[model samples]
Target: MITIDLITGFLGSGKTTFLRKYVKYLLAQGENICILENDYGAVNVDMMLISDLLGDHCDMEMVSGGCDSDCHRRRFKSKLIEMGMIGYTHVLVEPSGVFDVDEFYDSLSEEPLNRWYKAGAHITIVDAGLRLPLSDTSRYVFASEAANAGVIVFSKTQLNNPEAPSNILKYLNESLASISCRRKLKASETVAKDWNDLTDEDFKRIESAGFKTYGFEKQQVMDEHKYESLYFMEKKFSLDQIKEKASAAINDPECGGIIRIKGFFKDAEKGWMEVNVTKDDFTVAPVENGQDIVIVIGEKLGKEKLAEIFGEPAEVHAD
Candidate 1:
C-alpha cells in the first residue's frame, strides 16, 4: 500500500510552499512520491509553482476545481484510484482550503483504494501572525480543518508578528470550542521553526506524524458557506498595476469578503510573473512561463463589481 500524506490548511496558509519543502525531503529519503493537488479553483496556479519539482523520483497530478461537492469528490477518488496503479510508494495530497476532510478518509477507506493506500502524515499549516476577529465562517473553517491534524506547523513566524505564537494558540482553542471538537493542539505536537531553518530532524518528525481519528460537529457547510473564486484570462496589466488593483479588491467592501487574489500574466520586461496576494502580504515574483489569467478567491463575492475592478474576464468559473 502506498502512503498518502495529506497537507491541509486554510486559505493563504502556505500549503504549497510547505509541500514543496516536504516533497524534497521525501525524495532525499529515496521515496518515490506523487503529489496530487486537489485544488478548488478554476485554474490551479499552484501547479505552476511546483512544476520544476517534476522528475524521476517524483510526479505530479491535479484535480481541478469548479465542480459540485459530490462531483469533486468523485473526481478526487477516481484520480487517486488511477494514480494507485503507478509504481510510486507515496502520494502527497494537497487539497483545497475549503475541502471536506471526510472525503480524504472516506475515499481511502473504500474497496480498491483501501487495498492500495494507507494513511500517513496529516499536517495542517497555519498562519502564525493571523489578524484576529476573522469572520465566524472563517474561524469555523480554521478549527475544523486542524481538528484531526497530528501536527500543526505555523508559517510566517520569521516575520515576527507581535500577536503571534501565543495569540494564535488562544484563538485556535477558542475556535475549536465553537465547533464542539474535543481535540486541542498541544505544544509538543507543533513545529514553529522557520521553513529554511527546519532541520532534517524536524521533517523526520513531520514524516511520522500520523493522523488522529477525532470527530467534530459536521454540519451542512455549502448551504451556509458562500466562498467563490473569479477568474480573468488574457488581462493586460503590468506587475505594479495589478498589485494596485488587487490591493483595492482585497481591501474594499464592494468586492465582499475577499481573502486571496492570485494568478499569472505576461509583462513587457519580466516576460511571465505570478501575482500572489493575501490580506497580510503582497508578493509578485517572476516565473519562467505562465497563463494570462488571474483568480480572486473570497466569500459572498460581488462578481460584477469585481469584474469592473480587474476588467472583464474572458471566462468566469465560480461555485
Candidate 2:
C-alpha cells in the first residue's frame, strides 16, 4: 500500500513552509509524491506558493473548499480514489488549519482507499512563538490538531525566546485537559530544531514517526461560522501599501481576531507579489504568476471594516 501522510496544524502555524522542505527531501530521495492541498476556502492560495515544486517527481492537486462538511468529505474521498489509480510513492495531505482528523482516518478506512493506502506520518507543525491567550475555540483547535501527531515539530524556534517551545507545550496540555482529552505529549515526541539546520536523520525521523489515536470530546467548531476567510480580489495595492493596511487590521480589535493575511496582488512596478502576514512574520516576495486576490483568515472577522481596509472583498467563504 502506498503511504499517505497528513501534514496538519492550526492557521498560521507554518504547515506550508514545513511541507515545502519535507517535499524537497522526499524528491531528493527519488520518491514520486503528490501533494493534496485540502483547504477550506474557495481559493487555495497556499497551493500557488508551492507551484514551483510541480514537476515529474512532485505533483500538486487540491480539494477546493466552500462546501458543507459531508459534501467536502465525499469530494475528498473521490479525489483520493482518482489519485489511487496513479502510481505515487506517497501522498501528502495538507488540510485546512481548522480540520477534523477523523475525516482522514474515516475516509481511508472505507473500501478501495483502505487497501491502496497505508497511514504514514501524522506531522503537526507548531509555531514556536504561538501567542498565548487564544480563545477556548482556538485553544481547542490547537490541542485537537496535535492530539494524534506522530511527531509535533516546532517552527521558527531560533527566532523565538528559548522558553517559547516549553511554554507552548504547557499551553497545549492545558488545552487538551480542558477538552477532556487524556493524550499528553512528551519532549521526545517533539523536535524543535530550526528547519535550516535539519539534517538527513531528522527528515528520516519525521518520515518514520507513526501516529497514535486517543479519544477526546469532539467539538463542532470546525465549521465556517467558527473561522471566517474574507477574500479581496483585484485590489491594485503595492506590497508596501498592503502591509501598512494589514498592520492596522492586526492591531485593531474591531477587525475581530484577524490572524492571517495572504494572497497575491499586482504591484505597479514589481508585477505580481505574494504576501503572507501573521503575528510573527510579515513576508512579501515576487512571484512569476498569480491571481489578483488577498485573503484574511481568523475568527468573527468584521466584513465591513475589512472591506474598508483591503477594498471590498470579492466574497467571503468558509469551508
Among all candidates shown, the one with the greatest TM-score: 2
In candidate 1, the residue pairs with backbone N, CA or C atoms under 3 Å apart (3 or more residues apart, or in different chains) clash, namely: none
TM accuracy, model 2: 0.96
Q: Alpha carbon lDDT of residue 147, candidate 1?
A: 89
Candidate 2 — which residues are off by over 4 angstroms? 268-271
Model 2: which ten-residue window has the lowest total lDDT? 219-228
Error of 1 at 121 (Å): 0.5
Candidate 1: tens digits of C-alpha lDDT, residues 1-319: 8999999998888898999999999999999999999976767888888898999999999997634778888899999989999888999999888777888999999989999999999999998977777888788888888988989999988986645876787789889988888887788878887899998899999999999987888755543556777888777777777888898888889889888888887878668888788888987788766898888888888788898888876655543
Candidate 1 whole-model C-alpha lDDT, 0 to 1: 0.85
For each candidate, what TM-score against the reference? 0.95, 0.96
Model 1 weakest 10-residue run by lDDT: 219-228
| lDDT tens per residue, model 2, 1-319 | 8899999888988898899999999999889999999987888888888899999889988997645888889999999999999999899999998898999999999999999999999999999988788988899899988998999999989989888898888888888888898988888899998999998899999999989998799988855478888888877777778889899888888898887888888878888788888876898888877988888999889888877888888888764
lDDT for every model? Answer: 0.85, 0.88
- Clashes in model 2: which pairs? none
Alpha-carbon deviation at 104 in model 2, angstroms = 0.2
